[model samples]
Target chain A: MKFTCDTKELSRACNTVSRAAATKASIPALEGIKIDIKGKEVRLCGYNLELGITTMLESKGDSEEDGSVVLDAKMLCNIVKKLPNALTTIQADKKSTVTIKSGDSEFQLVYIPADKFPELPKIDEKSAISIPQAVFKEMIQQTIFAVADDAAKPIYTGALFKVEDGGLTMVGVDGYRLAKCHESIDYHGQPFDCVVPKKALLEISSLLDESGDKAVDISIGLRHAAFMIGNYEIFTRLLEGEFLDYEGAIPKSHATEIKVDVRTLVESVNRVALVVSEHLRSPIKMHVGNGQIGLSCATSIGAASDTLDANISGDDLLIGFNHKYLSDALRNAGCDEVRLQLNGPLSPMVVLPNSGDSFVFLVLPVRLKAG
Target chain B: MKFTCDTKELSRACNTVSRAAATKASIPALEGIKIDIKGKEVRLCGYNLELGITTMLESKGDSEEDGSVVLDAKMLCNIVKKLPNALTTIQADKKSTVTIKSGDSEFQLVYIPADKFPELPKIDEKSAISIPQAVFKEMIQQTIFAVADDAAKPIYTGALFKVEDGGLTMVGVDGYRLAKCHESIDYHGQPFDCVVPKKALLEISSLLDESGDKAVDISIGLRHAAFMIGNYEIFTRLLEGEFLDYEGAIPKSHATEIKVDVRTLVESVNRVALVVSEHLRSPIKMHVGNGQIGLSCATSIGAASDTLDANISGDDLLIGFNHKYLSDALRNAGCDEVRLQLNGPLSPMVVLPNSGDSFVFLVLPVRLKAG
Candidate 1:
């Protein structure tokens, strides 16, 4: 295989695909990136059992023969990144030795036959939906943090994506918190629901463009899902299990509501949480009354108290919460002002936009010991 | 004790002293910063058994009483860093509760009485010598990287500071490489030699001013060394042992010499070293002939080669070296062009400035296996 391309372009493509490469596996070929050269096109692919990423780039140098080889993903990426920013040529001989040269530097590495690489699962494109890259990225970022990392319940490790008519809603729920975001897309297919692994969504989010001018096509199959980016394609196995009924779990009624600036409340909570050490798991208390929220936390080492102004319209209430969960929700609210709904000290607090239903965040309060 | 000071100034002082605070110690007071409130001057001190740092800042608010307390260094630094950027007041009540307030945020932390904090050693200033902060800082940086991290010989872990005839020479030597830096200062004190711990020199270097106008007063006592910079004072125990005879170890003549651009040689060595993995322990070989140096490295995984232009004189030589040692010496040369002097394959390669003796870096060659 003989191909020449811009050193930076090759480096970027290697980085993108290597994210899916297995670091340690029984099969050695799973840790390699397969490079296939044909005419003027070169395709690079990296795949573990659960996820695969592939990208194609045009070569500038002419090739006398077409061939394929698998090289160690990490070494190839590092070598390319360090090479001088110039045109680089890579040629593989029949002896299973690959020579890479750029400027005055050259590297020769051993490679494995591409036939040893595992084949990626075929993606059915019957159920495909296109959404703007910016919107999709936002949807993933707002909900992915709530996914449970524990493997005890495998279903909770993935986010649920539900599409109906022209609207798509993504929900992530651990035991203590739930985050949901909805966006409208131009879709005219049967409604479907699928669970995407958190790892896949995170990788997809990083590859998405935030300019809002480009769109990504997503296809959901029976057992696999594929996301088609501009010049790259990411494929992953769909999670198989029953997901939480997030719609029914959300509280619909509230006894008290307060509107507060998101930044102000986030800062206050962060200061109060400083006293709550990891070894001593203490909850931050919030007293909402007289148009202000008094936040306080006392631990063995120290005690902190902060107050923030808010617009209140109902009975005063007192609540306790795990500061991290509350902080995450407020930061992800993505609005200037947020409305917080509380039923009582034991009920889950709901965070909503001041006017719209674009996003919803619910955090369960911690039970505080009586003073 | 009560005082008000600029939040930023107090935070900076805390960070400076906290570097000497013990992370985990049997004496809890050693992990805390002692704050002494007297009139309008507030002093903060952090001392482990081996090293201590103290700095003073001016307070704006009047105090009703003067006292001292020791607070947890990490917690105080974090709280001060997060507090609003305004005048911050700290007050300690008779109950041993310290209250810190800034804007609307308040933190009450339990403190230990200052009497429990260790006392720092007093240094006699009769043998004090002054040097420009920028010059001393450079001298430390040029040699510190060569200090041996292995604690087999405690003396080798510290740099030897030799002062005679208004000249200060700092030398750091491990078994394989040696780095020496010297500067001319305006001092007439008695000649003295002492070894300062690497940890202390690093902290002192960071606190030194980069601008050449400022000067730091350094006093060397029988067992302790002190550095006074602006409003901060740093004290450290002097390491006691016989040091390497660095001057006698350096060779006076060479059979071959070459002049090359520092940056070019550094980049070539870095690229060649990429193939030398940690587990493989391969040495990079330099073949000097035909007015260019050919660098190459081959390991079990792969091979890399690069060629750089140089001005060669005398006999052509082939030398092998550990890439890291070579890279460090070349980077610390601190010059646009460096002269390399070589005697033979087994002899140490000395790197020096093109003109003067401001710095000298010597790296021993690694013996190569027969081809």
Candidate 2:
């Protein structure tokens, strides 16, 4: 394979696809990026069986022939990035030795035969949905943090995407907390739901453009899903299992409600958490009063207490919670103020926007020991 | 103990001393910072037996009594940094429980008795020298990288400071390479030599102001060294051993000399080193000719080569060196151009300034295998 391309473009493409390359694999070819040259077009692909990323760019120089080779992913990326910002040429000879030249520097590396590389799984475009890239990115960022990393239940490792009644809702739930976000879209097909692995969603989010209204087309297939963003295509396997009924698990009513500034509450929680270390895994205790919420934590090392003014309209109550869960929800609320709803000391606390119902975060409370 | 102080000043003082606090120590008090209050003066100290750092600041509030307490170093720094930028008051009750309050936040922590903290070693000022903080900082930065980290030979783990003939020289040498820097100082004191631990030099370097010509007083004693900068005092135990005779090891003559741009050579060396990883510990080979130097490296993974123009005088030669040692000296040369003198393929290569003799860097050659 012989082709010349801009060094910056090649470096970016290599970086974009290398996220899916297997770091350690039984198949040696799976740890490499396959480069294919046909006339003036060049395509680079990286795959690790479960996920694959492919990108294409036009070469700046004339190609000697149409051929392909697989090079080590990490080495290729590093070499291209460090090369001077000029036109770079890559050529592979019949002996399976590739030569890369730019400016006054040259590198010769042994390449794996292209025939040994595994092909990406074929994705059938059964149902397609198009949404603004920024909107989709926000939805993922707001909900993906609650996904469980445990492997015992595969479904909880991914976020559930549900499309119904011209609305798209994404839900991520671990055993301790649940995060859900919704956005309106123009759709007329039958309702559908699918679970996408967290890894794929994070990569897609990073590649999305936040300012422009560019659209990303997502197509769900029988066992795989494909996401098309500009000239790049990402394919990921659909996680197989039944997801939890998050709506049924969340509390429907609350006996106590408190309206408070999100930033104030988040800062108070962070301060209290300073004394809670790995050795002292203490829970933060909140005592809700008539006009303020007192946040405190006591461990063998130290004790910290903070107070924030809140508009409360229910019976006073005391609750205990894992500081990390509470802080995560407040930080992701993406609003100035929020309403916290509590049914009892042991029930889950629901957090919602002060005026709208676009997002809902539920955190299960930890039971406190008797004094 | 009771006093109020500016939060920013308190935080900065805590951070300044916490560097010497031990992360894990057999003595519990060594992991904490000692705070002593007398009248309106507040002093903070952190010592780990080998090194000690102390700083003093004036408190804002009137003191009720004079007392001292030791608080956890990490917790104190974190709390002060995160607290609101306002006046903060700290008070310890009769039960040795300390309460820290600022704005609407309060923290209560148990403190260790100040009597348990170890005292800093006394330094009898037998000889003293003062130099500009900026110049001293630069001298340390240029030579400290060559200090050996191996504990087997404790002498090589510190830098040798020699004061003689109205000049001060700092030398750092490992088995592979040596770095020496010299500066003329206005001093009339007995000539002396001492080895300061690399940890102490690093901390002193960081605390020195870079833009001013302010002087830092350094006193060398029989068993300890003291560095006084502004209101902070740092005391460190001297390493007792015979240092290497660096001047005798450096070559006085060379068969070949080449003048080259420091930036260009550094860039080329960096590019070639990319292919030499931990698994492929290959040395870079340089071939000098009439007007240019060619650098190349080959391992099982790949081969890279580059050429740079230079002014060569004397016989043509070939040499090999570990890329890391070569690059470190070149990058810290602090000049645009450098002169490289080589005796033969097996002798040490000396890197000198193009115009002056203020600095010298020597790197030993690695023997290459015969083809």
Candidate 3:
């Protein structure tokens, strides 16, 4: 096989696909990226059973070679990344040895037979629905960070993707906190619900930023999902487990309420968190009363307290929390002001944007020991 | 202790000193930064037995109160880092409770009594010698990276600082490589040779960058050396040992000579080094002849080769080396062209800048097994 392509184009494609390649897979072929060429078109694919990513591009150098080869993903990607910004030509023999030539640099890398490479899961195109990339990316960001990182809690390992009529809602929960976000789309397909692994959503969000005005085409199957954005096609196996009733977990009524600037609250909590971080429990306390909220934290290392201006008109109460949980929700609120509703000192509090977009963030207060 | 200062200035001082604070020192007081105040002058000091860094700053906000307090270095630094970019006032009571106020944000922190703070070493001004900051920084960079990191080889843990007749020579040697750099300065003190620990030199270089045209004042005592640069003062206990005879390690004659572009050699060697990195012992082979030099490396993972144009007039021969040693020396050569002198395949090779500067870098070659 012989093909020539633009250095930058090849470099970008290699980087995108290599993210899915397994570094310590039991099967050696899983460590290689399969390159297939047909009629001046080249497709690079990487898969590790759980997740797969592929990108298709034209040869640019006008080569019409038709063949396939699997080369070490890291070796090929690093070479392309360092190659001079010029046209690059790659040639491989029947023995599966590939040579990459660009400017005055030439690299020879051994490869595994393409026949042993795993095939990406097939997508059911008839059930595909397209959503604006901006809205989809925003929804993912507002909820993904709340997902639990512990593998033992498999039910909370992924975000729930529930689509109905023309609206999509994503929910992420880790018992301590829950984030639910909704975005309207122009879709009329049959409603579906699936849990997607957090790792796949993170990779998708990273590549979606460059889509500009483009829309992402998503198709959901019984046990798999596929997302196509720009020239990249990403497929992943859905997380199979029962999801929690997040709606029931959120408190509906509150005795105390406060409307505060998101940026102000984030900064104050961040500073107080620094003091509390000395202790692993991270006890940052907030007292909502009068026209301001007092944020404070005290540990064996030191103590810090700060007051931020806010609009308050409910019962006066004090609540303690893991500062990280509160700061993260405020920063991701994506609005100038946010409304915080608290039922009591021990109840879960809800934070929502003041502009009336459909986003609900709930955080359970950490129980403080009596001083 | 009471002091008012610009938030940014205080933040910079705190960060510089925090680098020396111990994270888990047996003495808890070592984890704190001692803040001493006199009139409008403020000094921030952090020391962990082995190294000490202190910076003096004029209080941007005038405060006549004078006393001292010791606060958790990391906590205070983090709080100041996030504080509003405005004038900040820090006041401490005799009970060691401190209050920091800036704009709408106020923080209260507990501190340790200043009496527990370690005393800084005193420097004798009569034995002090000054060197241009830029020249000293360059000398450190040229030789420091060659120092051995193994504590077992204590003799190679620091650079030998040799001064005579206003000429300064710093030498660093690991078992496999040696680097010597010389800089001429205006000094008339008694000649002295001391080994300065690597950690101290690194911290000194970081602060010297901002010392534009100023000179660094260096004072060496029996067991300690201090460097004062602009607003920062750094002190450290010297490494007590006999330095290796680096001059005897360099060969005086060679059978081959090649003058090559530094950038080209660096890029080619860097790329070939990637292919051979899978093996512990790097074996990048260079064959010099006619008008070009061919660099290549081969391992079970892959093989890479590139040819760079060079000015060669000596015997055509091949030599192998751990490309890292060569690439690092070339990267630090600080010249457009570099000349390589080789004795044989098994002998050490010397690399020098083509512009005839006082720099000598030597790297021993790796032995190749029979093919």
Candidate 4:
């Protein structure tokens, strides 16, 4: 079959779809991306049994014939991207050798039989929920870093996504710290909650339309969820097992409330953490006074202390926490002003943006040594 | 001892001097950077026995006393950078704990006795030569990448620097390729050649001011060479061995001459190398025709061919070369139009800028199997 396509368009499709292709898998078919040509359109699909990505591209030339073949995704994408950005023509033979030519460059790539390719499972679109690209991408970015990478607790590696009555909440936790992002969406369906693999959410966010004007349609099934953007659809498996009750874990009341600049806190913790982390105990201590909060860390190697101007109105308290946890929470607070609510030195600290009550991050403080 | 310094200036001095400090070395003193405080200037020095770096910073406040101590370089730099950029006061007690306070942040860094630090060797500047920073930096960038990284041949790991007859030449080579960069300098001293370690040259290049207006004073001794740029000086041990006769190795004539665009050839070779590298024999073949040169690489996995427009004269020749060698030579050729001179398939190919005779890069071609 002989067909031609725009070089830029083809390159983008190959790159986005290739992310789901299996690498170093035993099955040769799983390593190839299936490309099908019909009339003036070409459809490329990449599936590794668990995850699948499909993208459609409009060919710039008339198709002499219709055909299908599975070609190595990496080589094809590399060749296309390096070729001059001009009209590209790809012609495949019955012998499973695909010839790709653009400008003065030509590549003859061998392919796997198309029959060995796995088919993407279909999701019912009738009950699909639509989400604005910006809303969904931001939610994933705010919570994905908190997901656990440990295999010992597989349930904690996935984020719990819940949508009900125009409200959407994404929760991620690794026991040490929990990140929850609540945003309003245009949804009127029954309340449904699903645990999505963190890897899938990250990949989807990378492909999300950055303009935020586009809407991503999501169809959730019993075992799989499909996210459809402009000309592509990604299917990811739903993680099994019950999720944690993160809402109940958040502290309900606090005796101390201190408001400080988010940027200053992040920078201070990052600096003091350098010296603090060099010792046996990697904890940065926070002491609240009348109108200021002091952050200090002392080790055998070095000692650092930083005082930040804050509005503190509660009993003086001294607390110790892992510097990394505090830094991450402060960075993700996403507002100029951040509120730190504390019950005591032993309890978890609730952090929230000064302007928003919808989003909150809870961090468990490291226990201090008793005298 | 007590002194105050500009936060940014101190941070820069610490970072530049820290490049030569040892990390986790068997000798604990090598991991520390020595700071010497005098009347109104502070000197920071980091030495790893083979290499040494020294930087001076001006004190903002009058010094109450003079002292010297060695501290961890990375921690000191991190603290200085993260602290608020304002006037910073640093004071050290007899116990060797140095207190550094800037704005609202304070750090007390433990230090080792300054007597344990090695003294930087003095360089005689009477017979020293000066070179433009731009010319020296550019020469390093062009040839440093070709330096051998294999420890088996320690001599090839450094670029031979020669100053004679008003010509400054730097040569770097591996077994497969050699890069030579030459420029005119205002040096009329006795002819001398020394091998400067690639690492030392790279570090010196990083600290050189980009404006090119500043002159870098260089002093070469029997065993070490010193490069002084502004308030910073770097000294590195010279490699002891007879350098290779690279000037004699370059071909004086050629059987085929191919003039091609540097960028196009680089991109073409990069793309075709992907497919070529996937096979057992990773070599790209170049064929010179009348008005065009074809580049092709085929393996068991795939095949790619690209033809670029070139002005080819002399007998047509077919040659094979390692893609990396060819790409490196092309990238360092600098000029947009590059001339490729080939004597035979087994002979080394000389690549030069179409208009300049001062610069040359020689690439050894891989012998091809007889057809």
Q: Which stretches of candidate 1 lie over 4 Å from their true place?
A: none
TM-score for each predicted model, relative to the true structure = 0.98, 0.98, 0.95, 0.96
Candidate 3 residue pairs in backbone clash: none
TM-score of candidate 2 on Cα atoms, chains taken together: 0.98
How do the residues B1-371 of candidate 4 rate in per-residue lDDT, one tens digit apiece? 67899898888888888999998788767888888888887888999988899988878896546899888887888788887858899889999689989888888887889988877776554356788897788888789878998657798989999889788899999888889989998888799888999889889999877784888998998888899998988999888898889989888888888888999999988888878652466679998886888899888878989888898888888899999888988887767888999987889888888877767888998988787
lDDT of 1 by residue, A1-371 (tens): 89999889999999999999999988878998999988998999999989999999999886535899999998999899889748999999899799999989999999989999998899775588899998898899889989888767898889999988989999999999999999998887899899999999989999999995799999999899999999999999999999988889899999999999999899888888889888987999999999899999999988999988899978898899999999999898878899999999999999999988899999999998988
Q: What is the fnat of candidate 4?
A: 0.97
Error of 2 at B139 (Å): 0.3
Every candidate's lDDT: 0.91, 0.92, 0.86, 0.85
* Alpha-carbon DockQ of candidate 3: 0.66
lDDT of 1 at A256: 91
Give the poorly placed runs of model 4, Cα more than 4 Å off: A124-126, B124-127
Candidate 3, residues B302-348, lDDT tens digits: the string is: 78888889999778988899988999899888788999999889999
Could you tell which candidate, 2 or 4, scores higher by TM-score? 2
DockQ of each: 0.82, 0.87, 0.66, 0.83
Q: Which candidate leads the pack in DockQ? A: 2
Q: Is candidate 1 or candidate 3 better by TM-score?
A: 1
Q: Give lDDT tens digits, candidate 1, residues B1-371.
A: 98899999999999999999999999999999999988888999999989999999888886635789999999999999988648999999999899999988999999999899998888765477889898888898899999888667899989999988879999999889999999998777688899999999989999999885799999999889999999999999989999999998788999999999999899999988888787987999999999999999999889999998999998999999999998999888778999999998999999999988899999999998988
Q: How far is candidate 1 from the true structure (C-alpha RMSD, Å)?
A: 1.3
TM-scores of chain A across candidates: 0.98, 0.97, 0.96, 0.95
Interface RMSD for candidate 1 relative to the native interface: 0.9
Model 2 lDDT at residue A303: 94
